[model samples]
Target: MTLYNNVFETVRMIEKEKLDIRTITMGISLMDCIDSSGDKSRQRIYDKITGYAQNLVKVGDQIEMEYGIPIINKRIAVTPISLIASASGEDNYLEFAKTLDKAAKEVGVNFIGGFSALVQKGFANGDRILIDSIPQALSETERVCSSVNIASTKAGINMDAVKLMGKIVKDTAYLTRDRDSLGCAKLVIFANAVDDNPFMAGAFHGVGEPEVVVNVGVSGPGVVKCAMEKVKGEPLHVVAENIKKTAFKITRAGQLIGNEVSNRLGVPFGILDLSLAPTPEIGDSVARILEEMGLEACGTHGTTAALAMLNDAVKKGGIMASSSVGGLSGAFIPVSEDEGMISAVQNGALTFDKLEAMTSVCSVGLDMIAVPGDTKESTISAIIADEAAIGVINNKTTAVRIIPVHGKDVGDTAEFGGLLGYMPIMALNKFSSEAFINRGGRIPAPIHSFKN
Candidate 1:
């Protein structure tokens, strides 16, 4: 059959080129778990999550081995903790977060997101408490993640919330200053944040979505690299076309299984997050695709252009294959999660500047990056400031998730192990932004920021 031939060709492409799927995250809404009584809230929330996700990890492992493709992470995202805290108080909200963390460990899941607040226009009592508790909650928990929506298209930019988040960023750093005090690593201040995002720290179950759903995030950096390797001298458009075709095929496979699993579990099926999520696996890297595209290295001048092309082409193909395509459907450049990127940073092929540039055009910001412990808190704030400026100006979702490895300096290796790959502490530009930060009030929204 023609389809069989296509499968064979794709397999051969995999043999020669390094291609693989990154993750298949299942988004589950927990709005129904909300309780009328404060004392019973935590128990209700935990019961709901554990019951729904009991088979999540088992199913993911089965699917991965069945297809002979690597599924890097099996993650879950739920309703924002703020809404879950409604009519409740800070004490109950923190309890709810603890429930989320405990259930994740009990079910053998890695990361559990949606401990967040949405205050685009203004803050509700629950939103305010949840946002305030972010630093303490993140500092205390190992597997919990959080994000806050401060701006959106339907609502104007919330300057007050942004200012508050800015202050909270500093406090989080100060309080948790012990573990690299990178508590802000688990928090993202967002604009136009999407619900049903399988990626963290922005993912959450939307009110409009189903009760439980499985969303697949398919990646094929190796596939793209191999395709690019063959079409070396082709025009950019031609190369992008080949990349789109590959993205379409990979997304289709994800869609197929996602639907099947959802049906089998008697749950509503969700969209396929067609992001080129990478991993520590050798042939499964977005940076490797960039390298294969003749960059020699990912942190070079041509990095952003290539990433933009790849990001766009991937969306174009994936959108056609699945009508429900959502989440951060683009290339992910998590430095500590991708082996090629870690190697590049170690070998002097990648730098902080290049990563910042790539973030402007890629899906997220400097995600999962590890920096020297000697880097000052101001320096960390500066990094957040830089990424926030990018999001504020370009109006894209840019965030900073840099880890401050305690007792590690530049060139030192920090091993998080597993999917959170090892990263060498990268050097930062020894420049002074101290005075500017000291004078921080608020970087008012851009004049053209009004998109609504």
Candidate 2:
């Protein structure tokens, strides 16, 4: 591997820009694991996951150690259980989720996504069942994640599913209210969501992939932020170039590990998602990168412009680095996960409205944010609607993982602990969207929707 004298500088950049491989997710398809009998199908599901992924975490650790690059998470995303709809009865969805959770825990994986249903156009019986069961399933499981695809560039947003999800989010929060509504933390509603995203709670093995493949997600928001600090209010062009250069180094680190892991595991190497995935850690923050880029605070008036530039530059560098780069390849603005961002929100420097604006350029949507527990379900849906609209219109992927902490209101803090971090619930606009949102059938695809 080529080496450089800028190693320490690179690490400093990584620390500030939240630049690290967010996740190295192994996608394992289990379509062939279905059987006519329920018991046999259950066993097939477990065995298939275990047999395919027993070595995932172990191998990932080895790769991380050898490459000297941190792999923040090693996980597995499977074909959505809804695909094998006939294997289990509608009422039996929980068991399937249990089986998945079991296999994930046995493999030493933190989260296993793909307990999903694709309803961009419409829903199936199985999809409906899984959707309905999400609150219970998530409340009961330790590591299972659920996502619903309600919109896409071609199909537009699904208001029906979005409404259902709002209720589900509320219910999940209620069920886990004592635990900070963590069950809701495992859920996301997406528009144009990627099938091969290595990040959760939205990641799921795309149906088009091989039986087993490894995709890596690398982040370096800190790296970029550090670079921006060095430039210190240089012209916008220079700032963008600095971001690109920092991204290049981070992508190189991801490439080094991704290739080595794929080779060791004898699986096809997949995409390198060069997203700026922040954590609660002091230095790892996408928001901090923006702050370093001259924003007084991340949720301020200038934040969106800063984030948009940062997002575009990272993509430029990552695209140049690898042919397989994919997923939500932009700065992720998860409030709770970034100590700086959470503080910004708590201090009234960041607001939910500004957060929505930022998602237009960010990788994920409204992630790890906290709101009033009693906030209307329709308001939650409105938040989802806003994000889906941006994604659909721009033909890009966007998603929401908002957590309405039960019994908590604006300015009150809610702690999720660990990497999820503690969040201060930001105040919501008291205005109602009921009149506008209630009339929804579909937000028609954007004017740029023309493919021909």
Candidate 3:
């Protein structure tokens, strides 16, 4: 009877609260595909990815139908292109990005990540080449996503990479201006990036990861929000407990889907990322969860405290549900992706500063936000620096995915269809950070970093 009741409850959550398997991401290592010739390397990569992921979408669809679960995406992540393409001594990696895009299309995945570089401490020759090619690569490829890890808790922040990314972002914006500078939407700059993240535009197959693995990302902000409504006027502790229980249920469901997918593909199960990723849908918003906690708006005075408790409870509950829980296992606050966040920004209830502050307690940082096209590159770099400092000091994974929509400004809307959503361009400070960003050097790791 109890098992039947639980199944019925889960069905209700799926029908009414938007519970979903956000993605089943297959991570493939390209380390073995490197060659002295760029063409050979590209061919090997294309063949490996398509061969491994050929049945990924088919299997995902089968499980979704068999179990009546909604799997939103079937995606792929590969070893950082910089590490593989560097062996070819290529001056540019545009063809590599195209190869990834082609492989993704062949496999029927929505996106393919890991056109990436890791230069937290310093640059490798391939890192510079990959970074240089990012703007053109992103502009030309329809499905290639890119990232750069420029900071880490132990390695500190790489300001040179940060500065370069700002200009790269601007160039991407210029190249894709016809599409509201959508190229910037596919790029992420990170601090303390995770090895097993199943989400994009920051998901990459770390060198330490297995040859091939299947990782699942689960999302249910609406489920948690609905649960919170049940305990309205209850003490904060009760709210926290309810959220944990809901999260536990969500995580368990995710593990079932993940294990099934892994077995079908003959790949190892990587991890279950139970992050409360939001969408532009009305009920499926993380900001709505915070508002349900008694705040008048999502960015009010107690917003950070509420978010801190919410993030902690979600992690605790997910940990209890599965030992394989990993990735950014907390609430995400991407502005354009969450309808409630977009409303809050338009109502003046949420400011850009408040969004940055909230990121200190949530999952990722400055995601899917649009700034004015005329905003200086130095300002964008400074924003990345601030978020990196927060992540480094706190020993957490944080990232920036801000978009400067060409010819768009405050009060203007940038349309990025589908799950990417749309947003009103938010205002930025007018002050210049040119002199500060010009000082290209590393910021040393925190004092507590030397735990060895």
Candidate 4:
């Protein structure tokens, strides 16, 4: 009887509030596919990916149909390519990316992640090669996403990798300038990046994960916004409680779908990421949820507090709904991806600095924002360093995925159709961080991180 009641409530949420399973991501380990020969290694990588995820889309669709729920994306995350390709002795990792892209296309997944390197402490044999190849790899591949972790609460920040990534981001934008610098959209630099994240541009099968697993990212900003609207003029505690209840319902739906998909695919069920991942579509914006909390607009003075509450309430509700809550389970405020966020930026309510501050409380950092074409690499590195510092000191996951769109400036829009959305290029401070970035070394972990 309770199951039936919950199903009916879920149906209502989907029908009216735009709740959805944002992604069904299959994590596959490619550790055994390594070979001294790059070609052989890539071939095995392709085979393993295609073999494991062949029915991923089909099964996702079937589950969606049976449950009358929307599954927005089907994705695959493999073991980090740097680890798998290190044994291949590959100087350049573009072919390996192509293999992953080919496998993704063959299996009909939206994106394949793990073209990545984990250099939070320092670079290893293949880390440099993978990091160097990111620009070309992302430029040449359509369905491949890449991430590099250069900072962590435990390992401190690698300023060298941060500096190099700034140049790599600029190069990626230049290479994909014809597509509104779409290549940069597929890349992310992170501090304390999680292995079970089902979201793109950062998802990767961690070394400690199982051979294969299924993880789901659930989104319901609309649902929470609607719930908040019903309690207008209420106190802050009331608003947070409302959001927590709504998040509980949304996460219950995700756990059901994740369990069903895992059973169907004969894989272990992983975490359910209850992130308020907004899209450009109407009624699906996280910024709107913040607005519903009585803010005139997002990025206003109270925006960060509102977002902090939203993120915490969602995590609290989601954890109670499912014991296996992991990944980035909070609210995401990507500028381009959320219609309200774009509007706030265009309306002069949101600035780059404000977004940086908001990320201190939100799930991800500086996501899907566009900067001027001529933005210097040193400035970009500085932006990354700022975000990483927040993540390190606060002991949380933060990432930067800013695109310095080539040949675009403030007031000009850089468009990438569909969920990638479009955004007016944002202005950056006219300053240089060359001297600071040139001092390449580690930013030691915070004193609080010495939790013994």
Best by TM-score: 3
TM-score for each candidate, following the candidate numbering: 0.87, 0.95, 0.99, 0.98
Cα shift from native, residue 312, model 3 (Å): 0.5
lDDT of 1 by residue, 1-452 (tens): 99999888767755555455555566777776677776577787788888988888887788767776656677788888788778554443667778889989998888888898888778888888888788778877878888887765445556567656655665665566675555656777676677777776667887777878877777777777777777887788888998998889878877876776676666777878888877788887888888777788878779899899999999998899986898888998999888789888988989989999998888778788777666665666667667766766776776667676666778678776666677888888899766656664545567786656
Give the alpha carbon lDDT tens digit for every residue of 305-335 in model 3: 9999999999989998876989889999999
Model 4: per-residue Cα lDDT over 1-452, one tens digit each? 99999777767799989989999999999999989999898889888998999999999999999989999999999999999998888689999999999999999998999999999999998999999999999999999999999999999999999999999999999999999999999999999999999999789999999999999999999999989989999899998898899999899989999999999999999999999999998899999999988889898999999999999999988999986999999999889999999999989999999999999999989999999989999999999999999999988999999999999998899998899999999999997899999898999988888889
- Write down the lDDT of every candidate, Cα atoms only: 0.76, 0.84, 0.95, 0.94
Off by over 4 Å in 2: 1-19, 435-440
Q: Deviation in angstroms for 59 in model 4? A: 0.7
- Weakest lDDT window of 10 consecutive positions for candidate 1: 13-22
RMSD to truth, every model: 3.2, 2.0, 0.7, 1.2
For model 2, state the Cα shift of residue 216 in Å.
0.2
Better of 2 and 3 by lDDT: 3
Q: What lDDT score is found at residue 373 in candidate 1? A: 61
Cα shift from native, residue 355, model 1 (Å): 1.5
Name the lDDT value of residue 394 in candidate 1: 74
